[model samples]
Target: MASNIPSSAGRNRLAAPATPGAATTTTPSRRALSADPTSARLSASARRPGGAATPHARAAIRAIDQRRRTLFTPGRTRRRSLRDQRETPRDILRNLSRVLAPASQPLPSSSSSSPHRDANDNTLATVPEDDDDDFLIERPRFSLPLQEDEDDSDLKVPRSSGLEDENYTAHSIELPRRAWSEGPSRLGRESMASVRFSDYAGPEIQSDDVGIDSALFPPPAIEEEDSGNVMLGVGDSPERLDVEESRRQTLGRESLFGPIEIPDMGNETTFLMAPADSPTREATVIDAAVENDEPGVFDDMDDDHVNEPMDFPESDDEDNDNMEVPNDAENGNIEEPDATTLSKPMALATNRGKRRKLGKKISKHGIEYPSLPPGVVKRLATTFAKTSGVGKTKISADTLDVIMQATDWFFEQLGDDLSAYARHAGRKTIDESDMITLMRRQRQTSASTTPFSLAQRYLPRELLQELRMPVPVPIRASKKKSRAVDAEDDVDVT
Candidate 1:
């Protein structure tokens, strides 16, 4: 039976073939185990209770835990001293001792120093605690360049109490001296007290004698108009020479040309005078007209018959004289309807007046009804209220009617415009594309106009998008009236 039992190689031969469709997975068979020695070792290590993989995994987990611990851990900080944090108000008297007192000398102890010492003793340079509390000098930390060396143990001093002074080993350090502190220069001293006024004065006045000459300022000459002629013209026959003297005066100073005629100054008229000038006394006749006294046009006409009124005969067969007669009833049992009764209903529904009253009777004999249905207006009003976030508003009938009429007027104008646009496009029916195109054109043309701005607020979001890309819109066709039976049966429950 041991010889007949199947070996590992025989068991491998009995296993299923590795088809392409079957999943290719590694199985621990002796053949595979012999091919890869490392995988076999790994498998053997995983099977054992104390494996190398377990130790390595534990080490990796420890390293990750350590990293996480370090990342989340908070650091500890040392307590800060008062000097390191913020500098307080220092006692100037205590600091002055450090500057002025000798560094080599040790400070006298409180027990050694006598309390009843002289008032002027230099050892009593320390300020009393009460005085220290009353006055404190706050100096900026960075103001002084020199600082006491930290390593110098002999110069160190503790905080002063009431009367004890500590030894301060002051260093004998030289400070840089500025040149400006020496003295003022000679030039600077002179410039300090002097004022710099400009030497430039205004232009010199030119003397009249500078350009004046003999031609410009000549000696005065007197005109001698022969005294004899003056006396003879004045004394001899003054009346007879008046005309000649007047003519000579009128001629003015005689030039080479003859006497010049004085220009005429016409009569001055007031503002109230007619604009047309008076006709001239001398008439200029361009053409002579011959007037015939005899009457040839109406020689046989009588003067007595001129004032008589002409009589017009009244025509009885004119179109305006013919009146429309009422039609007589043809059926006696069922009387024919009156023309007024038949037309009253049709006339009432039509938009006759520019503004039709909401609840006015259009017919002389009919029931009064509102032009716009109240239910439709209420529906529109509720929708408006909901959109505007106005909770439960009461709209008056007149106000609603006015709003409806205004809306109707606006729609009518829009329809007219759309009709015009359709006609321009060579189509009687207006489409969505035409509406989008018209609105876009209106926005572009009248961007600054009021109408476009108002329309923009009311335009739909999709229509605004369509304005950019004039895409053909899919219009849903309205459903036709359903059958009474179908409608009744198809009614929704709630």
Candidate 2:
């Protein structure tokens, strides 16, 4: 019977292979004791002493047994499946709420909050779709306004303080130096003294209304005195008068001194004085006085005097005719001639020098044109001059040829117009416009031959005509009807 039981137990274990290995123990048949249900119960009762369990231990054992039952039973597995389904829906709702929630609310505090707390909180506070329409229409949240008093206080202090403390020191310093020490100052002083002396001597001297005295000197005493002896002192004795007159004349000469004398000619000690009969002496004296008044007179005179004989050989013979030469005098040691009273022949000679310079310049760049229309040549010359980048006085032969070619092309293109314009001007010439058109056509032709040129190839004559003519209004039916109505109204008004 035990062997059969063993076989049966083995078959049962094979049928239920999912049971724990510990539940299928192998023990010796000799030690095996089979007990009845009553004895089993008695043993269990003995283990519990009074057949009662302590509430605390009973609860603990019941909890452990419940957990085990839940782990093992298929029904408990079904309960776990239900729990998973419930958790999935909850997680989805939580994620949705989090995604839809406003960003401004403080992030849910992590301390006491569950991971899903923010989601739950957001869902509860979220407005429904129907409510949002009205909510969106409400005024948007704006930043808080700053106090006016605070802004005013900030602006006032610095501006008011700057205005109140406006006094600032500026220092300009100059170094000391001697005043009125130069030659100009000395001349000014001498002039003033001389003016004062003249004013004191003559009451008839001109005086300004401002009480400023102006000294006016009398003409030379020599012009008034026939004897050429005018006493400068009170003594009238012949010898004394002569000495005084001499002194006075010397002073006058010094007062009217001319430019500094030219350097002495080396080893030359000769004088050639103009004859008394000749007016050259008087002329020289007057010229010298006038030259003293003119600045830079000496520089001009030096060129003439230094090379006088070489530049003006004719002047030497004239000088000989006018002057009394001593046998001891050098050949070319002539006294300086008066610049102001230069003979008419000499003036003519100077003018001829200028004319010669002008003639040379003209020869270098003068343009000689064939007998064509007056303005035609001028216009051609002007155009070529402008295009050639050459001066008006120096247009080249090539430039002239270009101008002639341009003029010929212009006449061929605009012959009738050229004749009309020339007729109006009473001259037979194509003017500046003809030249311009020729240049423009040439540029166009050149540009057409070149790649990627911006120059206009053809004149837009039709487009230009259209632009000059006014645009006509389209005759629409509605516009015609309105115009008829307006005409009827005007007739009624009349």
Candidate 3:
């Protein structure tokens, strides 16, 4: 059986492969034993009994505590101080000296010898033995810096009947000297306040056999009186020292947040109470006509929509009389604004936005409404001007169509009249003679002294100016003397 036991070299706890009729014992490894949290190496020293873990501890220990919670809040119930356990305020005050005394301090030896005598028994004995109830401890004032040799033998005890001053110092530490206040922080520069812990840090005490070394705690560095930083004197209390400011300390609006801006509340502007969605001049005039109750009251106003018919509400004459504006009839009446005047401001204010939206729509969608192509009339007008011997002529958009109509009619009449005159003279087309005869007839009909003067109305000014030269007088048969006389003589001779 022993031969079948596994060796400890491989740290394995299983039995080794056994021969026939062989047996073995396998000892558990240290790691396998330590797998239990109750093992001596795994358990904390506090949990182990006698600072050592035993087998019985394994029964209660777990790898992770089953009852462990993330949050922990201990109970606040307390045994309370002896002073708090006392019944009355005067009783608590009567025993304050005993409560503050350390446990090591011996109890007061009373006149009646009792080792277990408490504060109440000591107070009762003191009251009967002595009638004087006044205290003995006198608090030393801050008239001078505490000397180097000074210790807690100084501070006055608050109460005294039971506890003695011997071996019972209220506080062990003594007050620091004025020079000892100088530290790494700006201690002396600031007023007595709720200061940092570092500001209170100063030189540590030297060897107890000797006293504090003055070299370790140096005097405060001298500051200029003109620099305005003040430090209290050794004898003076900080509460009584008054610090004078060079300038008044005040929080100013301009100083803290730069400058505050107050809005212009009383600014002048047109305020309209009425709501008008569409802003157009025609609507303004229409509103006026309605307010005045006259269909044509604002008809004289110049507007593009002036010719567009308006549908005025048909009212009886009695209603019109009732609606008549009272401002015209009564001398004492203060005029209330009519609807038209009220709408004027709103219409004017929204007019710019409407125009902007209109321009935006036209630009974005490229004029989707029914309309001629852009600049078509302009190009035609330019072409006509160029053809009529006036290339620099700039036509007005309002009068361009009218000018075109007049031009077409004028040319048609001139062409048909000239063609008729040519046909009457046995010709198919016009010659210079026809033009001269036409101009002479036009000049006579128009009562113009100059020949072809009416041609100026039809032709461009530049062309007519160039054609204003004198015409060659023709030698007519009526003007010829002998040549025309031969016609009379020839008729007589025949």
Candidate 4:
């Protein structure tokens, strides 16, 4: 059990608070404290009928309160200066542009006070610099120390190099820079006015050749002759000359059909003109050669005689050249069709120019069935025999036809079955699942290893190589199975 009695040293330590720095008398009890409330005061935590606290309690509590002054106290956040807080992004960008902006030079002697400021340029307000240590974006320039010699200044000085001690000597702590000065802008805002239009082109497009619209059909040479070496002469003569020479236009049946009457013509130009209506055979050109010394001539005519005309048959006699075609059955004895004419519909004869018909027939069910030729069917039968371990065998035409019919019937039944399966699955189109199910049913019905044993057996080697075989269950092979060990000498053992 812990002692409730106060020890002498503890009593002295507890009693020391009665006087300033005095550790003589024992402390008054809690009842004495309550009775003499004016003489001994107690806090709410220490007021439960307890003795007075030790002499150092006030100093210890004071030290603790001093330590907690910062621990529980909220901190003071760093706030931006009033200048930065007031500055907007627009103000910042404008200030930064000064780094690239051309140095302020006195304007040229203009008639007006300001130099050519447009409405847009007028809208841009110049932002004032706050101080030398303004934001970096606002002051992005550096200057060199003033030099005494111009030749030395011409030499390039490396920037941000280790030799700043020589260039910058006065201010040891301050960064090396010339008093701030502006330079020409990199943004090229001065050219903004020119780029506003639609035809603001960049660099001129240059190629080895400018061939637009001129590759295949190159521009015709600007010379006299065309690409072809052909040159043109006069065109067809006009029916009538100008009023000055209106007399030479006469052309009549009398002049054309009359006998060769040569008119005298010397130094005067004359022309032969056909009648406007020329198809009526107004002139007869079939006559023996006749010559006339004096001949009428056109303005372009050569020395003329009555021209010799070749003897040709009369206009009515030319009808025999074109073959007569029978328009109806009543005139069936017309000329035969031309051998070179491939148009069967236009052919008059029934036998000639007919399309070569195939061995096709319509079934009793009104279905058009294409019959296989005897050659193909015989070849297929031979292939089937070859696959069945038989020698090449020629099939009879009747037997080949029967095989073809059976094949056609089998395919017809297969299509019906596949369509029925697709319909059962509520699909108009057949898919692989329906095919697998159909193949399974066929294998079950025929007791064959594959769905279509004959098809698989007779398929070409290339096709069989591409097709994958499907088995109901996978067969696991032994690790040591080799057919070479099973080889046997059936003929003889030597």
Candidate 5:
């Protein structure tokens, strides 16, 4: 048995070597081979079997593919099918009827031709139910007069109250009766003639219900003699009417005439209205005088005194002649005392000292004489005294200087008025009260001239209070340092 017989294992080994390129030349067994053919065929079919479908499946697939292709195509039957499917069932039924029904059964006629027809004539016409019965009840008709008469019969008549029982004559009736007696009356013949004229003038003559004559009414009339022209009411000529209307417009209705009374020509003491020719006469006479007289005819009228040079202390012969004295000098030069020493004296002699100093300084300096009258000087002195206080002492140099300058200015301004007052009243001194009044008058004049600047300059505390002008709130001093100190103390304590 061992003599040259190959085992099944050796046969397998030899078969495996025969197919060298296939997985190390492993050959399958007969049974494995038999099983693999059907599996391979199945695997091949699963992977890529082109003609393996059943007839029914292939038909279904074909149908689906045909439907997809048709659906994708433009203007295709499938798109038309989709549109037919989307149509309403009623439309479908309608289409079906058209297709299936006999030609003898015609479609409905249009609704516009028949008033009672619906959109489709096949629909029945709708009717509204009567609703008047719910809202309206039956009522018997009766005449208002009959109803009122019946009511009057049943109801008692009320007696009149005595409050309104007195007879009331209308204003119109009283007006005619009252007015007829006021004006001049015409004779009966004249009245009859006027009435006859009215008939020719217009229509029938009829009085108002209140007995007012129609002739009295202001209305236009047709003139029989002058048919071409229309006549206005009596007393109304065209020119007169136009003038009256113009007057009414220019002067208001109440003032139809010019001003009834003229205004008073005030205070003719100083002012006079010269005769119209007087000015010409005066001018001619003045011209004649000027022509007759020399060019310097009024040279002597200049009474203004020239200022003379002030005289200084004579130290040498040359200096004495050169030291010119002012012409209007009243006193010699007085040394200006020390400011501190002069304070009390200055306060006591504020008015007198101020005037004297100004007068002496002006005189010594040979300044032009201020023709200050005695009254103005007294007024300025009094004003200074009043403002500085009567008994209060210790005056400042600045205040004294201001007083002196102000006094000088005041005399210069009111020189003419002061001269008149002094000449008329025979007064030599001006007082503080007078000065204050003059200052107040000046302030009033200045305020009128320059309101805004005056307001700013004179914004005193009293004025501010009266005007309720707001005062700024004072800010508190900073407490930051104190707070810091307190914080430092706290830190130290802690």
Candidate 6:
């Protein structure tokens, strides 16, 4: 026989009819059976097998149920879109048509209908007969005198859709009427007065007190040609006229200080020298000699006349007598000695010759020095001696004098060198760059073993930058280091 089995045991049991109100024993689940020993013992007598469950499994089931409920929940807000926020062109056109439509259209008097009922009719009502009053309402606007070009832009319209057609017809038939009814202003008097001219016209505008009504002061009779040139008095001759015309036009007028007085220099006495002895030639020769390093060029020109005392005439009569030129034939040919010629030897000796005050302040050692203040020189000597590590040592007067002389010589040499550098650059004024250039050149010419050995210790930052030269990096503290090494060596030796 075939086995009697149900396809689904739980569903078949649920669907089966129950015997009337029978008392039933509670059935334990397989998990409950596994978890309790008493239930497990009782289930061992039963036919089916079962698996065990813990508290963690029940918690996982609860969490899964909560997630399912949350996933199915509805959103709090409705969806939004850009279309809802902006308008379409169709809507815009509709609004514009509504705004431009005529307020109402005239309707025929229907015997039974009210006027208010017809007033709410569509603006595109059927065209009625053209009555005179309706057409003449805007006739004043067209009858006005003013005429101007109207833009086609003002005349454009969409294809006569019902409302747009009515707006166009209304705008064309009833042009806006102006309320200004006054006549044009009376300006002819102002125009004529503005064109009239009087002699006193500007800030000098005259009061109407003179007897003449047209002008305060009547202008004198003056004649003019069409060329805008006025005719003055005629000249005696064409040449005289040309001269006067040129004289007026040449400088607008003559000199402000009357014609400048060019004195009679023709008779002035001038002593002319030969080209070889002229001042210009002498300067050129001196420059050439200096360039060639000639020591004798600077020597006294009149060696024999040097140290001679200058002699001036005792009286003005004697000077006048020397200056007077004798007209006698014998003496006329003989040239008198010029004062310049006579004084040149004295000038050369006084300027170029050696010290003449050699006996006044000469030391026993035969050294002659310039006059320097004793107190200042003494202080300088003390400072120098201290700086040189000769502390508290009394400087002898002769030594101070020597130091002063040496300092004076050093400053004089420096000034001369700076002047020579300025002259080489063809400038009379000495600038900061000249000094910097001289110092840089000096540094370059010297040996690389001594990099900081410049004539001047510091240069301006601007000059350094302009020259694209690096700022002077301080030399390594080699002096102190060397001194330290020396001290160490001395200690070792000791």
Could you say which candidate leads in TM-score?
4
lDDT (tens digit, per residue) of candidate 3 on 1-494: 24433343222222222111111111111232345322322222213233223333322332122112111101122223432533655445536845765564543443333323443455655655653542233223423332353232343323323222223232223437544234443322211221222222434432221122232223334443212222223112222101110000111001111111111210111121121222232454454456555434333232222212321111122123222434333545444434523553355447434333222111111111112222655676777787899756787755665554454345445655787799999997786567766766776522222233334445677776665443443543123323334544565589
Residue 341 in candidate 5 has what lDDT? Answer: 29
Off by over 4 Å in 2: 1-338, 343-350, 357-431, 438-494
Encode model 6's per-residue lDDT on 185-240: one tens digit a residue: 21111111111222223321232111111211232223221011112112211232
Position 97, candidate 5: lDDT: 57
Q: Candidate 2 on 1-494: residue-level lDDT in tens?
A: 35656766775545332122212222211111122111111111112322212232223333433445445343335554345434555346655756866554544443334424544554446646445322333344343332333222222111111112212221111112222222122221001112121122322223321111111122223321112222322133223211212223332311111111212210021121111121233554465566456545543443333422432354334333233233213455444333312353355456445433222100001111122443556665676568787556454657665555565445434544555556676875765434334445557423223211111122256654543253352333234435545655665699
lDDT, model 1? 0.32
What are the per-residue Cα lDDT tens digits for candidate 5 across 76-136? 3334434544565645665775676566543343232343332233232322343332213
Q: Provide the clash count, candidate 3.
A: 1
Instruction: Work out the TM-score per prediction.
Output: 0.18, 0.12, 0.15, 0.21, 0.14, 0.18
Cα error, candidate 5, residue 83 (Å): 99
lDDT (0-100) at residue 338 of candidate 6? 43
TM value for model 6 = 0.18
Error of 4 at 271 (Å): 64
**Candidates' C-alpha lDDT:** 0.32, 0.33, 0.34, 0.32, 0.32, 0.33
Q: C-alpha displacement of 336 in model 5, angstroms?
A: 28
- Name model 6 segments beyond 4 Å from true: 1-375, 437-494
RMSD of 1: 56.2
Q: Model 4, stretches more than 4 Å misplaced?
A: 1-374, 386-392, 444-448, 451-457, 461-494
Candidate 1: list runs displaced more than 4 Å: 1-374, 439-494
Our tally of clashes for model 1 stands at 1
RMSD in angstroms between candidate 5 and the native structure over all alpha carbons:
53.0
Could you tell me how far off, in angstroms, the CA of residue 310 lies in candidate 6 after the best superposition? 22
